[model samples]
Target: MSELSMGDALKLFLQKSRLKGSMQAMQITDIWAELMGKTIARYTDKIQILNRTLFIATSVAPLKNELLFQKEKIIQRVNEALGENLITEIVIR
Candidate 1:
């Protein structure tokens, strides 16, 4: 009924496809690295997404504590980076 521009069309396609969730999940790591910086990245053992939650495994206790304090901020930053609200909660271990 209506024509969509290439950029808008592709965005709609991605949204409608069922691949959007997977794509968003993959983008989390890269976005974390860019936003959190290398210092945090260096200590991060693993990052995972499960049921809209982010699970982080870290080697440093202090870093883990610090990240916990910034959990809400990190969620906001990650969503801002993806331009969508994908992460609901962050679990640091």
Candidate 2:
């Protein structure tokens, strides 16, 4: 039998683990939800995550400003949780 090169070994591991895509997606959503829950718990009902985008709806228009102010913190927290930059943008409405 031939030896497996490092690249091939990584590919085989990904295929065997069956977690190359969906797992990352799930983790992204989970991280988004958790971060919102922790940092913006009051707005949980208004938060939505879609394909690398985050949407937050607030009943009070002022809260939009609050969300804007915390944009960097939110992104940093989510990235820390996910171990990568998953959320590309955030919208407050």
Candidate 3:
């Protein structure tokens, strides 16, 4: 078998572990501002991932409506940023 680099090994482990979703959620949170924008990220109150679904919580009504319309784009941007098709759905609240 070929040797795996440290980064590759860790990635393999994360992929097989139950912490994958949590880890991905953290990663998404970390990059949210950069991924979306300061305005959107600032308005976003919470982010969670479960069963490949992304949940975004924002108290701003206008922002929530805007997010609802951008669900598809958000999924694409998030998955692309993560370098994987990890998010399959999004819930805006």
Say which candidate scores most in TM-score: 3
lDDT of 1 by residue, 1-93 (tens): 999999999889999988877777778876777889999988998888777898999989999999999999999988899898888999998
lDDT of 2 at 59: 69
* Residue-wise C-alpha lDDT for candidate 3, range 1-93, written one tens digit per residue: 999999999999999999888899999999999999999999999999999999999999999998899999999999999899989999988
By lDDT: ranked, best first: 3, 1, 2
Q: Which stretches of candidate 1 lie over 4 Å from their true place?
A: none
Among all windows of ten consecutive residues in candidate 1, which has the lowest summed lDDT? 23-32
- Candidates 1 and 3, the one with greater TM-score: 3
lDDT of each: 0.87, 0.68, 0.94
Cα TM-score per model: 0.83, 0.55, 0.95
Model 3: which ten-residue window has the lowest total lDDT?
15-24
> Total clashes, candidate 1?
0
Q: What is the lDDT for 92 in model 1?
A: 93
In candidate 2, the residue pairs with backbone N, CA or C atoms under 3 Å apart (3 or more residues apart, or in different chains) clash, namely: none
